[model samples]
Target chain A: MALISPSGRLRRTPFSDGVEAAGVKAYTVYNRMLLPTVFESVEADYHHLKKAVQIWDVSCERQVELRGPDATQLMQLLTPRPLAKMQVGQCYYVPIVDEAGGMLNDPVAVKLADDRWWISIADSDLLLWVKGVAYGRDLDVTIDEPDVSPLGVQGPLADDLMARVFGETVRDVRFFRFGRFDFQGRSLVVARSGYSKQGGFEIYLEGSDLGMPLWTALMEAGRDLDVRAGCPNLIERIEGGLLSYGNDMTRANTPFECGLDLLCKVGPEANCIGHSALQACAEEGPVQQIRAMEIAGDAVPGCDRLWPLFDDGRQVGHVSSAVWSPDYQTNVAVAMVRKDHWEPGTRLQVQTPVGKRGAVVREGFWA
Target chain B: MALISPSGRLRRTPFSDGVEAAGVKAYTVYNRMLLPTVFESVEADYHHLKKAVQIWDVSCERQVELRGPDATQLMQLLTPRPLAKMQVGQCYYVPIVDEAGGMLNDPVAVKLADDRWWISIADSDLLLWVKGVAYGRDLDVTIDEPDVSPLGVQGPLADDLMARVFGETVRDVRFFRFGRFDFQGRSLVVARSGYSKQGGFEIYLEGSDLGMPLWTALMEAGRDLDVRAGCPNLIERIEGGLLSYGNDMTRANTPFECGLDLLCKVGPEANCIGHSALQACAEEGPVQQIRAMEIAGDAVPGCDRLWPLFDDGRQVGHVSSAVWSPDYQTNVAVAMVRKDHWEPGTRLQVQTPVGKRGAVVREGFWA
Candidate 1:
C-alpha cells in the first residue's frame, strides 16, 4: 500500500498537539485536512468510545461562515430544506444539492442570526458551491471560511466531562442546538451535536490561540472520566448509519437516493437549485435508496472500493462503507440498494475485495 | 507518521493497478484522488526521471469540462486570462479568481473548440466554483467531470518513448498544444504538456477501461529504454520554481502575488470575475510576491507546514515548498515574500522545524 503524502494542502487542526500526544494511529483526508481516523486502533477506540469519554479533533468540520443580508437568501437557494423556521442557536442537518438534485454535501447549518449562518460542512468543497452561487446571482452575502474549529467531546460520559469544563449550564443544551459559553474569558459556541451517535458536545473553538489551552483544560477535567484523544470511529459511525459524504454519497447520488427525501421541501418556492428536479423525484421516489446491511463474514478487508451487491446475476446495489462492529459482532455496512432489494430482510450477495459474501438488509442501524 | 485510511473517496486512478504492480511507495491525495509522490524514493525517482523515461499517473489532475453555448462566456468569467485570443489547439495557463481577486485555481484551459474547454485543474476543487458561476448566472453551459485521466510520459527520453508508442506524428505536438492521436483505435487528446521541467506529453485517456492497456503498452515498448513508473517529484518541482496550489499558493493569494501577472488581463474589458479588483491590483501592485530561495542547510524536513521567514527581528515572508535537490545541491524553495524582501540576492533567515537557516533569494530556478 502507498503511504499518503504531507504538505500544507493537507491542513493541520488546532488540536494536533493533543492528538499526537495520544498517539493517533492513522488518518484520512477530509476536505483536504488531516482528520485522525484511529488511536489505539479502530476496534480499541470503538470500545473505549461507548464506555468512556473521548476528545475528538473534528476541526476538519470547518465552518463556512455566511454573513450579510443575503445570507439566508443564499442558504435557501442551496438546499430544499425550509429554513424560515430555523431559530438562532439551532443546528439543522441540511443536504445540499445541485440543479439536478444530486447531493453536493450533507452539512449542519448553524444559524447565528437571520443575517448570519455557518454551514459546518462534510467532506466535499461546498464552500466553493456556495461562493459560486453568491457570485453568480450578485447576491449581497459575504462568504468566507471562518477560523471556527469544532472540537468534539463524545461518549456516554461526554456531558459529565463537558460539565467539568463548560459548567453544568451545558446540560441544558438540547440536541442539534448551540449556546455561547465562556472558556478562558472567551465566549464560544458549544453545541449538543457530533458525528457519533454517542451522546456528546462539539465545542466551536473560535480562536486558534486558545486551542491548546482548551484542549489542556478538557484533558485535566476529564482525567477521572477517562477522557482520551479520539476521532470519528469507523465502526461506530457505520453502525449508526452516518453516511459519509464522499464515501456513502457524491455528486452522482441525489438526496432522495440517500434517503434524505424527508429533508427536501421540493416546490416552486423551495428556491434551491434542485427544486424542480427534486419535486419530480419526490413524487416518483428514488430508484435506489440508502440502507443498512449486515455482511456475513469474519473480518472483511477494509472497504476502499465499492462492493457491488448482486441478486443472482443482476447488480442490485453497492456497499460504500463497512466495518466489523465489535459490539454487534457483525460486519455492519451502508449501501444504496435497488427498490425491491431495499426491503428489510431481503437477501443479497456483496462482492468484497476478498470474495462474495451473503448480506441482508436491515430495517435500522445497530445501536 | 501515521497511515492514511483507505476508502473509495481516496479515489483510485485507472493506472492504480500498474502503479501498485510497479511498487508505488507513497501518494498524496489531490482532488480527492491518489497521486503518486514516490516510487523508489523521491530522490531515486528524481535521478531516474532526469536520466531515463518515466510514466506518471497524474490522473489526479482532474478535468472540469465545459460544454454548450455559454462555455466560452463562462470560461471568460472564471479567469483573468484573455480567452478571446486563445485558439482551438492551444492550452493556456489560466489563473481563476473570485470577485475580490482571490485565487480560486490555477488550471490549464484546454480549448477543444470555441464552445468547449477542459480546465485541467490543480489541487483544489475548481469544478464547484465553475459550476456555481454557471448556475448562479443561469448560463447555457453544462459543467461536468469527464472520465478523462492524464498519463504523463516524461524525462529526457520522453519523445523517444512516446514515438515508439504514438508514432512520429506525436513529435509535431508543440508545447502547450494538443492533437488527437489514435491509441488502440481510439482517438485520445495528446497534449505536449506535463507538470515537470523535463519535456513530456499528457495523453488524456477519455475512457477508463483502456487505462491498463495503455500503461502496459508504454511499459512493454520502453523496456530497453529503462522506462519506469514515476510521479511528479518534489525536488524537481521546487528546483523548477513550480508553485503547488495548496502549498505555495491558496485562495489567500492573487495571480499577481504568484507571478502569474503575465497570464492576467486585468481590466473592465477582461470580463473575468476578479476584473475590477485585479485591475486595481495591477495598478497598486501586490503587497507580497512569490520568490525562489536557496535554504542553506542539509535536506530540510518535508515542508508540510509553513516555515516563517524572518529578516533580523521582523517577519518577512513564508517558504511553502522546499526540498533537498540532489541536482541543485541545495535546499531549493518557493516562497511568498514581502515586497522589499522579494528582490533577487536578498538574504533572509528561515525558521525551519529543526532551527533557523540563512536563505538567499535566487534570480532564477535551478534547471
Candidate 2:
C-alpha cells in the first residue's frame, strides 16, 4: 500500500510493526528487533517439492490494473507483444521494455474483463513504470495496486489441491486463465500462473490480514489434499530455466538478448515505448543471445555479475545464472553467449573467482 | 551493519544504493505491501535441492555471541538447563525463557572456544536479552549481531561437496562440530550443522562481497558435486518434525510445554534466567505438550492457530501446525495438546475454521 503524503509523493505505507521485512516472531527477545524464523536447506527441499507439493506466500507479485479506453494501447506500449488479440480470461506472458529495448519487467497480463487488465509483474515497479508511460501518452487508465495478496499454491498436485479446496470450479480454469470466486465470503481471483513450471495457482486476496485467515482456511480445507507450508527453493527455479529479474537478468538486459524476440513486433501505426530501438534490434539481430549449458563437476554457478566464458583461450560470453540439478546430477546454467557459440552442444569454459570451470551447451528446460 | 548516530543511537548501515535495507528485495515485495518476493513463485525450489546440494543465504538467522567471564552465568539465567556438561565443538538446541517459564528464543548454542560461545539464534535479538539480564546480575558477557552472513551448503551430497570444495579437511569435522581453515587465502569457520536433517556444511562469512566469489569457487570446485540453488520450503521441514519457533511456539509457550524440558535443568547450583518458572512448571508438569498428529483427511493440515481439540464435546487441546505430506499422501501436523490427550493413538476432533477436523495422536517425528 502506497501512502499519498501531504506533498503528494507516493511513499510506502509503513506497517505498525515497522515494516516486518521478514515476519512476526512467535516471541520477542532482548528489545524485540529479532524473532525466530527457520530456513530450509536446499536438497531436502528439492526432493520434497518435485516429488510432492508445496505452498508459498508470493504476495509480492505486483498487479497493475489497466482499465480505460486506452488500456490496450498502454499495454501495447509497455510490452513487446501485442495484446490486441488477447481476450478476457486469458493471460499472456508479456515483456515490458524501455525505449532502448532494455527489459523492464516480465509480467503475466490477465484480461480480467473487457477493459480491466491485471498485470502480475516481476521485480520492477510496474505501477510506477505504467504511470510514467501513461503521462504524455494520453492513455485513459486507472492504475492502482489492488489489495491482493497472491498466495502461491504450487507443486505437481497444485491443480488437484486447488480443486479440493476452492471447489471443483478450479479444475475448469484453463492455463493462463483466471476466475473470480467467493471463499469464506471474500472475493478472490484465482489464476493458473506461478513461478514454478509445476502446475499451480496464484490466489489473489483483497487484504493483507486476509493472508493468515486464508492461509488457515486453505490448510483446513487442504487437510485431505496434503498441502504443506513451503517456500520456493532456488534449485528447481534455476534448473527449470526460469529467470529472476535481478538475479538472472536485470534492467540492463534487453528483451532480444533475454530470449524474448518472439515478443517484439514493430508494426506500422504502433507507437509503443522503445519502438524504434526494438525495431533496430530486430533488424540487426541481438548481439548476445541467452542460452543454457551443462557444466562439468558439482559447481554452483552464481549471478553476482556476468562471469567470463572462454573458447580456445578467447572470450566468448558470460554465464548469467547457473545451478547444479539434483535430478540430472549435473550443473546446468543459463548464459548470454556469442551468436556463433549459442548452438546447443557447444563446449566452453567459464571463469569464476575461484578458478575456471568447463561447460557444454544443453537444452534449457529440464522438464 | 550498525552505524552510530551523532547523538549516539545506533542506525543500520546504509547501502550504496541508498537503500537502508539492502538485499531486502530477495524477501519482500516493495509494491505488494503484503506479498513476498516475485521470484518465489516461478521457482519450485526444493525438488532440485533434494537430488543435489544447495547453498543458501540465510544471513537472516541472527547470532548472539556471549564472551564475558560471566557469560556462563547468563546462559544459566536464560535457560533452565545446566551447561556444565556441554563441551566445546558441540552444540545444544535449548530454549530461553522468561520468569513465567514462557518461551523466549530457541537457539542453537555452539561453544567455539573456551568461554567463547556462538549461539546461532532464530529470528530474535537475544543479544539484548542477554545484555539486559547481565546488567543487574552478577555476570559478564558481550552480546551482539556479528557482521557475518551464514551460508548453508545443504543436501545429501553436502558432505562430498564440502570435502571437494573445502578439501578433505572438512571430512574430519563431525556433525554439530565446527573448525576454522584457510581456503583460497581466506580463513573461515566451517560448521557441519544445517537445518535439513541431511548432511551439510555452514560457512559464516564476514562480508557480502565474498558472496559471489565464494559461491563461484564452490561451484567450480564442486563441478562433480551436484549443487543447486535452493531455499528451505516449509512443507518438508514440518513433515520432518522440525520445530519452528514462531509457528509452533512463542513467548507465551514454556519450555516445559514445547517439549524442551529435556534440555532444561533446575539444579540449585545453576542460576539461569527464568529458572523459578521452569522449576515450577517442571514440578507441576507441563499443562500442554507438543505432539505430532495424523489428520484424517487428504486435505493438507495448516497452521491455523490452535484448533481446539474436543473429545466427547469436551475441550481437550489444540492443534497448532499441520501440512499435507506428499511423501506420505496424508495430512500431518504438530500441535500443543493437553497432557491428557497427548497420548499416541488418542482420537480427537480438531475444530478448524471450516469445521471439526478429525485427528489422531501420533509420534513426534512424523517424517
Candidate 3:
C-alpha cells in the first residue's frame, strides 16, 4: 500500500502532537480525522496492548451534540434504542437507521441530561442527517459537532494507570457509565467503556489545549506500568466480534443482521425513524447475518474488499474482515452468511486475494 | 507521515487496479475512498499534467441520486442555487446548505431529467442529509447513492486524447454540459468540466466492471499524448483558486463568503432550506471572506492545519490552503481574510509551522 499524505481536510486530532512525538507508524482516516493504526507493528502492538496500558487517540469518534428543549424528543426520533428510559451518564449503543431500516451509524449515545446528549459516532456524518431532519421538521434543537475528543486508556493495567492520574475514584466508574471527574480543576467526562474487549476508560477531553498536558501526565504517571501509545487492534477486535460500521456492515444492513438485536426497541411507541421497517424486519428476521468464521490456512492478507464466500461455486456470502490470530493459531474472519449456511461447522470457500481458502462457520467469536 | 493501511471501510475506486499498476505512490482518503495523490511525484505529475493528458481516478466524488415524482422539488430544497430552469443536460455548481446558511457541500448537480438528477458530492455524506430532509418533509422523493464514479481526462492534450476513444462529438460538450457518449455499448455521461484550470472532461463511469477496461483503452489510445495516471495536484488547484470543500471551506462558511455569489439566487421564489438565513447573510454581508494571497517565501510545507494570519500581532484571519507555484515563482495561497484586510496589496503575517512569513493580498488567482 502507498503512504498517505497530509491535507487540511484529513484533520489532526487534539493529541496529534503527542501521537507524533510517540512516532505513530500508520494511520486510518475516520470522520475526517487521523486515527493511528500501527505503532511498532500490528502483531507486536496487539501483544503489548493485551499486557500493558496504552493511550489511544480516538479523536475520530466525533461527537454530534443534541441540545435544546426538544433534544430528547429529536434523539428518540433518530434511533430505535428507546432513549426514554436511558439514565443520565449512561452510555447506550444505539443503531441509527433510516426510514428503510438501513443503518446510518452505530454510535454510543451519551446521555448528559434530559435535554443534552452526545452521540459518539463510529463513522459517517450522522450530524448532517440529524440537522436535516431537525430543520425539515422544525424541531427546537441545535445539532453540531463539538470539539470534544476521546482519549482512551486500555488493557489489564488500565485502571492502575488511570488511578495514578485521576486518583482511586476513577476505578469506581462502572462499565458502560460515565462520571464527571476533576482534572486540572475542570470536570471531564470519563466513561468506563472503550472499543476493545480489554477493560478501559475513554475520557471525553473537551479542551484542545489540555490534550497534550493530559497525554504527558498519563505517560509520566504510568512510567512503571509499561505505558505506550496504541490504537484499536484489528486482531483483538475481530476476536471480540466488534463490527466496524462501513466494513463489517453498511446501510444495506439492519441491526438484526449485525447481531445488534439487543439494542433495538421495536415494540409499540418506539417512535424511531425506521420503527415500522425495523419492526417488520425484527419479526420476519434477517435472511443473512454476521458470523465468525475460521479459515484453514496461514495468515490471510488485509481485507480491503469483501471476499466472496461460495457453497459449491455459488455465492452465499462474503468475508468483511480477516486476520491471523497468533493466539488462536488460525485465521479468524468475520463474514455475513446466508440463513442455511450460517450454522456452526458449515463448510464454505472464501475467494480471497491470495486464492481460494477453506472456511467454516464458528459458533461464536473467541473470548 | 504514517503509511495508510487498507481496510474494507476505505473503499476502492473502479480504476484502482489501473492506478496501482501505474505505480501510485501516495493516497489521501476522500469520502471513504482511496484517491491517488501522487503517481511519480507531486512536482513531476504537475509538470506533466500541464503539458500532456492524464487520467484521474476521482471515484471519491460519490453521486447522490434523486429519483421520484418530487425529485426536482427536493433538489431545489437542498441548494440556494435556483434549479427550476436547469436544463436536462446541464450541470450546475450548487451550494448545499442547512437552514442556517452553512455550507454542507459544494457539488455539481447533473440534471438527468425533470424527475431524476445526480449530485456528485465532495467529502461529507450529503445523501443522509438529503434523505433526512426528504423523509421529514414527507416529500415523494427516493434518495440513495448510486454506483457512479467520475474519471477525469485532464490537461492541455485532453481534447485530443478524448477524441480517440470518445470521438469528436466529445469536443462539442460545452463547459458544464454533459452528453451521453457510447463506450462499449454503454452511454456514459461525459462532462467538459473538471477540478482544474487546465481544461478536461469528466466521464461518469457507471459500472464497476468497465472501470479497468475504459482505463486501459484511454491509456492505449493516448500513448502519443503521453497520457499517465494522475490525481488532483495541490499546487495546481491552489494556483487556480479552486476551493476544496473540507480544506478551503467547511460547514462554518457560507457560499457568499466563498466568492460564489453568482450562483446564489435567493429571491422570494427560491425555496432552498437556507434561503432565509442566506438572504440575511447576503444582506448583512460576510465579515470574513475567502481571498487569494501571495506569501513572500519559497514552497511552504503541506498545510495540515490552518495557519493564523496577523496584522501587527493581532489575529486577522487564517490561510486554509497554500503552495509554491512553480510557474509563478512564489507561494500562492487561499485565506479567509477579515473585511478590513481583504483588499489587494494589504500585508499580513502568516504564522506557518516552519516560521512566520510576509504575505500580501493578491488581486486574484493566477490564471
Which candidate should be chosen as best, given DockQ against the real structure?
3
Q: Which stretches of candidate 1 lie over 4 Å from their true place?
A: none
Runs of candidate 3 exceeding 4 Å displacement: none
Model 1 alpha-carbon miss at residue A82, Å: 0.6
Q: Give the Cα error of residue B279 in candidate 2, in Å.
A: 66
| TM-score (chain B) of candidate 1 | 0.99
If the candidates were sorted by their DockQ against the true structure, best first, what order would they fall in? 3, 1, 2
What fraction of the reference structure's interface contacts does model 2 contain? Answer: 0.00
Distance (Å) between predicted and true CA of A16, model 2? 14
Give residue B178's lDDT in candidate 3 (0 to 100). Answer: 97
TM-score, model 1 to reference: 0.99
- Candidate with best lDDT: 3
lDDT of 3 by residue, B1-367 (tens): 5699889899998899999999999999999999999998898999999999999999999999999999999999899888877899999999998888889999999999999999999989999999999988999988998889999999999999999999998889999999999999999999998988899999999998999999999999999889999999988998888999999899999998998988888877878898999999889989999999999977898898999999999999999999888899999999999999999999999999989999999999887
lDDT of 1 by residue, A263-359 (tens): 9997666778888899999999899999999999898889888899999979999999998888888999999999988999999999998889999
Worst 10 residues of 2 chain B by lDDT: B1-10
For model 2, residues A144-185, the per-residue Cα lDDT tens digits are: 667665677888878777776688889888888888878778
